[model samples]
Target chain A: MKFKAFLTDNGISLLEKRFLPALDKMGKICHLYLTRDHAFFLHNLLNGDGIQSIAQFRKEALFDDYRISSQNEDRIAFAVDLSLLHRALRSVVTIYAEFGADGGAAAVPPSNRLQIKLVKKLPPHSQQAMPFLTFETKGYKSAVIQDVPISKPLSRTDVLELQAALDSAQDLPQTLVQVPDMNQLQTFVDRMKHVGDPISMSISKCGDLHLQISTTLITLGAEFRKLLVIGEKAQVPAEDRNLTAQSRSERAILRGDAMSVQVSVKHFSKSLQCHLAKPDCAFYGIAPQGACLTVIFQFFIPGTHQTDKSISLHCRLPVLDPGSG
Target chain B: MSSEVDAESADLECELDNVQGMVDALSSVRWKRHQDAVIELSEHGIVLVVEESSCVQAKVYLQKELFVRYEYSAQARVRFGVSLGLFVDSLNTFSRPAHSSTIEIRYPGPDMQLLLRSVDSLDACIYAEIRTRIPETISWDYNFEPAGSTPLSFTVKSAALKEAIDDLEWPGSSIQVSLQPAPPVVTFRGEGHGDLQIDFMYYANTDLLTAFHCDREESHRYKYKFLRATTSNIPSSVIKENRGSKLTIGRGGMLKVQHLVSVAKQSNSHSHADSAGYLQPSRIAYIEFFVKPEVDDDNAND
Candidate 1:
C-alpha cells in the first residue's frame, strides 16, 4: 500500500493552525487514512476516556495531486505520533512565512510543492520496517528532507469500526440548528464549565434553544430564540425516511416540544474551540436523544462566495441519568 | 425584606452602551489571589470589591450617572458575592475591539437572581442569570485621612506609572514608594539582586506629574505582588480620551490608586459643548486599588 499527495499551502496552514490544536487535546497517537477521495486523521484517546476525534480533508480542496494504491478496497491507514507531525508542520510553516515564494534565489526557483511520501524502509538488522512519512522540498539553496517515524497501522477491525461510525452518523436522525452567532454560546459554555459538569441542551420545534447547567449552588440557563432548524434532508433508508418525516412533522405540530440531551460541558466546550477559526457560518448536527453532537464550521475561500470546504468536530459525551444531579 | 425592594423590582434596571469598559477594569483586579468578589448595588451605583490575601483590595465603582439608566431600591442596599471568574468570563464574551456591545443589568429583588443581557453589534444577545449569596460583612474601616496637615499625594499619568512599574526588576518581594516635598520627587525602590531606584522629579517633568503634595519625607513598602495587580488597568485607562491616574499615600500606610475611565458615549449625542447640545458621558467611572503596606521588621527602625 502507498499514499502520496501534494498539499496546498492554505490546506496545510489550516491543518496546523486550526485542526492540530484540537487533535492534540484528544491524544498523541493518531491514524492517517488516505484515499483518492479524502484523507482522514483519526485519534482514539487511550486515556481510558474513550474519546475519539477525526479531521477529514477533501482531496480537491486540500491537495493538488492525491494518489493511493492498496490491495484492499479500503483506504490505506498508518499510525504516527501526531505531536511529531505537528512539530514538523510548524517548522514548515515557519520557513514559508520567513521566506516568501521567491526567497531571493534566482538560480534555484522556490518550489511550492511540499511533497509527502509514505514508503517502507529496512533497517540494517531488521528484516522489515514500518512505513515512514517523509516530507521533502527544494529550498532556495538546497533540498531538505524530514523523516517522521510511524508505528504499526491500526488493526483492520479498528479502522472498520471508525468508518462504520462515520457512515452511520450520516443517516441518523439529525436536526440542523444554525448558529447565527457563536459568541453568546461560547460565553455560556465557558461560564458553565466553571460551575457544572454536565450541560443540558434542549431545542424546541419553534427554534428556541436552551442551554442549562445545574449545580447544588446554582442552576443557570440561557435561552436563544428563533434559531433556524432545518429538517433532516440527507438520504435515509426508505422505511426510516418515512419515520423521520413523520417525527419531524409531529415536532412541527408541538411548538413547545423539545429534544434534550445532556453532555459533558468540558467535552462540548472542547469541540466548540473550532470557533477560533472564525468560520463564516456554523451549524450543529444533533442526533435526536443521542449523546453524539457534531459541530461543523464552514469556511469559504477568500474573494470567492463558495463554501465548498468545512471542518467538522464530533463529540460523544456520556448521557446524564435523570435521577442524578 | 424591605418594602422598597418590592417597588424597585418592578422597574429597577441599569443599561450601558458598552460592556467592555467594565470588563477591562474588573480584569485588572481579577488576577489577584481572590476568586470571588462582592457586588454592592446602591442608589449611588454599582461597586465591585475584590479582597485578596486579606492584605490588598481592589474596587471598581460604576456611578449611577455612568449608566444610561440606573434604578435602585430606596429602602436598603443590595449586595451579593459571585464567582469573579465566571462573571468576568460572561462579560468578556461580548467584548470585541471593533464594536462595543450593549449591556443591561437588572436586580429585581433580594430573592430573584441578577439578570444580565448583552447585545452585540450583530444583534446577537446573551442572557445570563447569576445566582447571588449574601456577602460577608467585613469591617473595612481603614482611615484614609492624612496624618499631618499635608498629605503625601500625587497625580501621575497612567502610562508613565505603568511603564515604570513594568521596568522594575523582578525577584523583589517589596516595592518601596517614597515621596519627598522639598524638590517634589517620587521614587520607587526595588531591592532585589541589587537596589534599583526609579525617581520622577516633579520639577524636571511637569507633564508626567500632574500634581504633587507632600509635607515630609515618607516611604512605605508594600508587597510587590499586590501592587503588581493594579498595574494591569493602567494600559486601558491610558488609552481613554480623559486619562489620569492618582496615587495617594493615606494614613496607616494605605496606598490608593485611582483612574477615571471614559466609557461608551451615545452615538447620536454629539454636542461638544455645554450649551451646544446634549452632553455625552455625563459622569465618569473610576476604578481604585487599595493596598496595605507590609510591616517589615528589618525596615521598621529605618
Candidate 2:
C-alpha cells in the first residue's frame, strides 16, 4: 500500500527556519520536478549555491529511465533557464523523481528506484532540436522531453558547407601556438581535454598550450564549468548588491593669448594631460598639485609670422568625469 | 668715355625723372588752383608754398601737440603762439645753413621744436630729415609691464615731411579740360625702358574765373580756394587731353588677318584696323599738359 505524507503547518514552519537557513548559508536550495512515475530522487551534487545545482537536477529529472519505463509516456517538465544545458555531450543523462500537480495523483505509490541513463541523443550541432532531447530508444517511452520544441531552421548545414570550403583552401590560415616552459609548474588541472595530454604539456609564452588545443580546452572547460555552475541555486550576496560610486574634478583655466592656452590641473591620473600640435609652440608646464608641468603646445596657425600680431589664443575646458563602471 | 656717357645719361635722367613731392603734398597738379602748402621739387630744393588756404600747413608743423605746461604744477594752457625753426641741410651732414629759416605762425598747440629736410637724389635719397629728441627727464624713467609673463616691448616712431612749399600766390589761368571721342571707352598701351606705363583721364572742375588779386601788388595772394574735381569711368582719350597725350595705339573697332602658307590654298578675312576703316591708338598712351608759368625766383625764395 502507498502511504501519504502531508506537510503540516508546524512542519513547514520548522523546515523554513531550519532547512531554508541551511540552504541560504550553503547558497543552494532543493528543487521539485513533476514526473509520471510520481517518485523523486535526490540527484545532482552542488555547492551551497543553488544556481548551478538546479540545472543538474533538471537534467537528471528529464533523463531518468526508470520514470520513462514505468509510465511509458512523456511527462518531463522544463527547468527555468534552458541556457544551463550548454554543456551536454552525446546523450543527456538524468535521474527520475515523482511529483503530483493534483492531490488525487499524490495517492499513488512512488516510482521505481533512482537511475541514470541516456534519455535522448542529438545530432552534431543540431541546433533546431536545442534544449529538447529527441531519440528512439525502445525501452523508453517518448523520444522528446522539453517545454517547447524549436521551430526555427537550424544553421548547421550552412556552417558545415563553410567549414568544408575553409578546410580545402591551399593557403589555409593558421594560428601560431605559443608554448611556455612548464617544467617549473607544480600543479595544473583542466576539466576539458584538448590536443596536449593533460599530464605533461608545457605552458607557452601566453601561459597556454598549442593554440587550437588551448582554445578547445578553454571552450569545453567553460561549458563544464557552466554545467557545474547551473547545479546550484542561490541568491545574490550583500556585497554584490552594494552600490558603487565614481567621481570627477573641475577644470581650471591658467592662461590664454592670441594663439595658445594653458590649463591648471588639481588632481587626476592618466585621463588629464596637455594636448598640443606638433611643430608649433613647444609647451612646458606643471601637473598634479602645484604649479610647473609639461605643456603640450602647437602653432595656432602654421606659417604665420612669429609676430605677436599674427598669433591668436583660444582656451577651452575639457569635460572631466569618471565614466560609469 | 662710357662712364662719361653714363654720367651724361644720369644727368639727362635727373632732368626727365618724375619728382615725387613730400608724402602729403598737392595730390594732383591743378592749374589756377592753390593748395595749402604744395610740396614741389625744383632745381634748387624741395619747397612748401603757402597759399590762401594755408591753415593746414601751419597745423601739420605743430608736432600734434594740443598744449604744454611750464611746470608739472602748472595748468596746461591753450598755446596760441609758439616759435619753431625749420631749415634745410645737406644730406651728407647734419649741419644747418649759416642763416636759419624762420616763419611766424599761429595755431592752437604746444610750443615744441620741429625739423625738416630734403635730399637731391630721388631713388636712394630720403625726402626729408626726421628727428625727435627724448628729454633726459623722461627718457629712462618708465618701464612697461606685459599682460602675462612676457617681457615688455619698445618701438621708435618718426615721420618724414615737407616744411614749406614755393610761394603759392601765382595768378589763376583759364584751365579747360576735355576728353576727345568722349564717353564709352578709350584704351591705350605703352612701354617704358623698364615697367609698363599707363595713363588715364579723369574728370575735372574748377573755380578759376572767381579769383581776385591781393591788394599788395608785390604779394602773390588771392581771396579764393581751389575747388576739387570728381571723376568716374575715366577714359584714356580724356586722360590724353588732361595730361598731354603720349605714344600709345588703341584699336577700338575689330579687324582680322591671317599669316602662313596653305598648301591647298584657303581664303580668309584680313582684320587690320586701317583696312577695316578703324584706327588703333598709338601704343604709348595718354598724357596731360597744362600751362604753369614758373614762379619768379626771388618771389619763391621770399
Candidate 3:
C-alpha cells in the first residue's frame, strides 16, 4: 500500500480544533478508517463498555492532491492514539498559524505545505517493522515533522467487522427529534450526575423526551414536550414505500408508548462532548428495541438551513440492563 | 393527591416567559457541595432555599410579579424538597438559548411532583416532573433583627464584593470583614501565609458603594470557605445585569448578602407589552445569603 496526501488549511483547523478535541474527551485511542473518498474516526465501534462514536469527513473537504492504493479496495483502518495525533496536528496548525496562511492566500508556498504520508518506521531493536502516520509542516525558516505510531492495518475480516458496525450506526429509529437547546441538555445531564448514575432516556414518537434519574432521596425527571420530529430522508429506501405505508398504522400505536433505554450517565455525557464542535443542530433518536441511543451532530451553512455535508458526527450509546427501572 | 379534577385552574401554577431568567436566578445560589433545597410556593412567588452546614444559607425569591401569569389557588402554601442542582439542570433542558421559551411551572403532581412544561413550543413539548418530598424544617430562621440602633449595613456592587472575597481566597482559612463608619469603606482581610486585603471605598465617581450605614466601627471574622460559598454561586449573568448586593450585619455580626437577579427577558425582548398594557419586564429576583460569623474568632480578635 502507498498513501500520501497534502492537507488543506481548512482541514488543519477543523482537525486540530474541533474534531480532535471532541474525540479526545471520549477516549485515549480510536480507529482511523481511511478510504479513497473519506476519512472516519471510529471510537469504540466494536463495543467495549464505552459510547461508540463515528466522525466522518469527506476527503475533498480536508485534503488536496491525495493519493492512496491498497490491496483491499483502497481502504485502510488502524488504531490511533487520539492524544498523540492531536498533539501532532496541533503543532502543525500552530506553525501554520504563525507563518503560513496569513501572507499567502492563493497558493501554499512550497515550504508551507503540509504533507502527510504512511511510512514504516523500522525500530532498530526489533526485526519487525512498525507503521506510522507522518505529518510534515514547514514555516518561516524552520520545519517540523511528527510521526504518530499507528496500529497495523486491519485485515479483510476486521475491515468487514468495522463495515458492519458502521452500517448499524445508521440504524437509528425514525422518531428522532431536534433537541431544544444544547446548553439545556448539557446542564440537565450534568446536574443529574449528582442524583444517580444510570439515567433513563425516553423518547416517544410524539416528540416527548423525558430524562430521569431516581435515587432514594428523589426521583427527578425533565420532560421536553412537542419537540420537532426529524428524520434523514436520504436513508429511507424507495422500495420500502410499501413498508412505510404499513408501518404508518403501527406508528400510531407507538406514538403513545415511549421507548426507554437505561444508559450510564458517563456514556451519555461522553456523547455530549460533541458540543465542542459547535454543531448547527443536534438530534436525539433511539434505535429499534432500545438497543442504543443515537445523537447526530450536523453543521449548517451559517445564515441558511442548508446542511454542510462535509462533516458529520454520530454517537451510539449502549443501553444497560433494564432491571434498574 | 389525584383528587384535584380542576387541577389546571386550582393548582399553584405560574408562567415564566424567560426560562433562562429563572435558571440564572437559581444558579446564583448553586454550590457544588449542596443539593437539597426547599421550594415553597405562595401567592407572592417561589422561594428556593439551600443551606450549607447550617452556617451558610442562600435563598432565591422569585416574586409572583416576575411570572407573566401567577395562579396560586391552594389555600395553604405549597412546599416541597428537590435537588437544587437537578432542578436547575432540568429547567435548563426546557429552554433554548437563542429564544426564550414560555415555561409553565405547576406544583403537587398527582404523585407530589413538580411539573415544568414549555408552552410556547407548539410542535414540540418539553416537560420535566421532578419528584418532590415533604420539606424538612429549615435549620434555624434567624429573626434578622438590627444589630444595634444604627444597624450596620452597606450596599456594594455584587461583582466587586464577590471579587474581593474571591481574591482573598489564597491567603488563609478565615477572613476578617470590617466596615468602619468614618471612612465609608468595607474591607476583607485575609492573614496566613501572606496577608491580602481588598477594600471598597465609597466615593462620588466610583460605583462600588451605593449605600452605607454603620454604628461605630464593626469587625467580624468569617470562615473563608463559608464566605466563598456565599459568592461562588452568584452566576455571572446576574453581575452583567448591574445590581448591588447589600451586606447587612444583623444581630450578633451575622452577615446577610442580598443580590438582585433580573428575571425579565433580556432587554432586547423585554419590550413586548401584553394586552393589559401592563406586562412590565421589570422583574427582579431577590437572592440573599446569610453567613454566620465565626464567633470564637471574633472573641480572639477582640
Candidate 4:
C-alpha cells in the first residue's frame, strides 16, 4: 500500500499550498513522510506559552517532541525523520533528533512572532551558502536566517557531561548530546560495504525509503539565522557505469554521491536558494522560486536495445516560496 | 517499424537532454560574490570557488558576549580586500551608520592607544547574526525628550517615567545637575547614595535629562560626560545614533532614551506629586560615559 502524505496541522497548509506540487513533479516517491513535530509548535502556540513550548524543544528532548518558548520571544523547533520516507528507506538507516520535547500547555498570551528552521543531512564538501525558507502572513513576508555550522568537535569533557546529563535529566541544552548509536553506525557501515546491483527492480520491491536528518539552529545577528546539521550523507550512483554485479554483495567499491546543502534567506522577503556542492551529481531539479514544478525523467535499460520496462505517472501540487509572486 | 521510430526519438531526446543539462549546470552554478552580505540563516559552512586573482574573505562577528564565547573577539576583524576600488568605495559610501548597520568599537580603550582604524565599526540599523553557547536573559529601556525645548517642559511623572526606568523609586531627595562653563562641559553633578546605571545626557538646552535605570541588587550611579565644544558641535542625532550605541548581549532587542538639556539660568522644575526642590545626591557615586550593553540573539538565521 502506498503511504499517503501525512502533514501535521502546522505544516499542512504549506504542503497543500506549495510542497505537494513539487513532490508530484518529482514522481519517484512511493511514500512521503510529512512529520508530526512540524505541527507540534503551532499546536503549542494555539494552546498558550507557545514560545516556551518551542524553547523546551531547543533543550534536550526527543526528536519527535514539539517545543515552543516565549521566555525571551516566541521561538519554535520542528524536526522530521526522513528515514521514514519511502524513497529513502533502502538508502539511509536511522534518522531522528538528539533531543526534543513539547513546551506543555500555554500559561500566557500568544506572541505574534514567528521563526522556522529546516534541517536535513549533508555531507562534507558541500556548498556553504543556503537557500532561504520563506513564508508569508498578510502583507508581511519574511525569511528566517540560515546559520552554517562551525564544527564543534566534541571534547572528552563534553562527552562526559553528556553522559552524566543523560543518566540524570538535568542541564539539558548544555549537557544533552547526540552521539551516533553504535548499532546504527554498524548497520550503515555494513550497508556501505555491501556491493549491490543497480537498484533497478519492479516498483513494488524497494524497502523503507527514508531521509536521515539532524539539525541545530542558532540566530546570530538580527539579520541572520543559522541552521547547522552534522554528518549528513546522501548517496547517489554515478553515471556512465553499468551495474552488472552478479550478486548484490560484489559491488562494494562503488562510491555514492555526497551532497552538502545550504539554504539562505535574506531579509524577511527576498529570494531563497539552496547551493548544492556537486551540481552534476544532483539529478533532482529545483523550481524557480520553488514554483509549482513538473518534472519528468525517462529511464531505460542502461545498455540494452530492448524495450521491456515502461512507466508513466503524473502529479500536481503547490510549491513552497511565500515571497514568490 | 513503429518501434524503430520510437527508439530513434528516444535516442534523440536523450542526447538533447544531456547537452541541455550541461548548459543548465553552468548557468545554475554561477557564483555570486559576497563580501559581507548579511547572513539570513544558518545552514552549513560556506564554500565558494576561490579565484587566484580575486582575494576572498568571509568575516562573521557576534555580540561581544558571543564573540567572547567563540574566543574570536580579539581576532575578529572587518573583512578587507586587496581590491582598491572596493576599499575606497567602502570608506565613502558605507562610512556612515545606515539604518540596518551596527556601531562597533574602533579602539580597545585609553590604554590601547589605538585609532579608529583598528576599531570595529558597528551597524546600528542591521542586527548581527549571533549564536550563544550560554543562557540568554535580558530587558530593555529608552530615554525620551523633545528634539528641542518647547513651551511645555516634559515632566518625569510616575507613569511616563516608568517606561524609561525599570522598577523606579523616588530618590526621596532632589536631584539637580549643574552645567558649569568649563568650555562647553556637562558633568554628572548629582547627590544620591545608591548603586545605579543611569544614562544621562544633554538635549535642547532646557532639559538636564538623567534617565536612571535601577538595579537594587547592584549599586549604580548615573554619570555624564562633559562634551567639548568641538564634540558638542556634532548634532545629538549623531551621538544618539553612534555606531557603538547598538550591541546585542544575549537575546537581541532595540531600546531608546530621550535627550533633554536645561538652558542656562533656566531651572527645570519637577515634583513627584509634591512641589519640593530637593536634589538627591549619593555619598558614594561613580559616573562614566559608556555605550549601553546590547544583547544580541541574532543567531537565529545562521
Candidate topping lDDT: 3
All models, DockQ values?
0.16, 0.00, 0.22, 0.07
TM-score of 3: 0.77
lDDT per residue, candidate 4, B189-250, as tens digits?
23456433333332433233322222111111222211110122222222222211111111
Q: What is the TM-score of chain B alone in each candidate?
A: 0.84, 0.17, 0.90, 0.16
The alpha-carbon deviation from the true structure for residue A97 of candidate 2, after best TM-score superposition, in angstroms, is: 99
The lDDT for every candidate, in the order shown, is 0.66, 0.20, 0.78, 0.20
- The digit string of per-residue lDDT tens for model 4 on A172-262 reads 2111112122232222223322121111100000110111111121111111001111232222234212221111102221221111111
By the TM-score metric, which is better: model 1 or model 4? 1
Q: What's model 2's lDDT at B9?
A: 18
Candidate 3 residue A202 C-alpha distance from true site, Å: 4.5
Give the TM-score ranking, best first: 1, 3, 4, 2
Clashing pairs in 1: none
Model 3 Cα lDDT, one tens digit per residue, B180-288: 8777778889999899988878765267888888758888889999889878878676566566788898777788988887777644554333311124545878898
Two-way TM-score contest, 3 vs 4, winner: 3
Interface RMSD, every prediction, one decimal place = 11.1, 48.3, 9.1, 25.5
- Which one wins on TM-score? 1
Model 3, A141-207: lDDT tens per residue? 5678889999998998898899888987877677787788886678667766766779877776656
Give candidate 2's error at residue A203 in angstroms: 99
Which scores higher on TM-score, 1 or 3?
A: 1
Ranking by lDDT: 3, 1, 4, 2
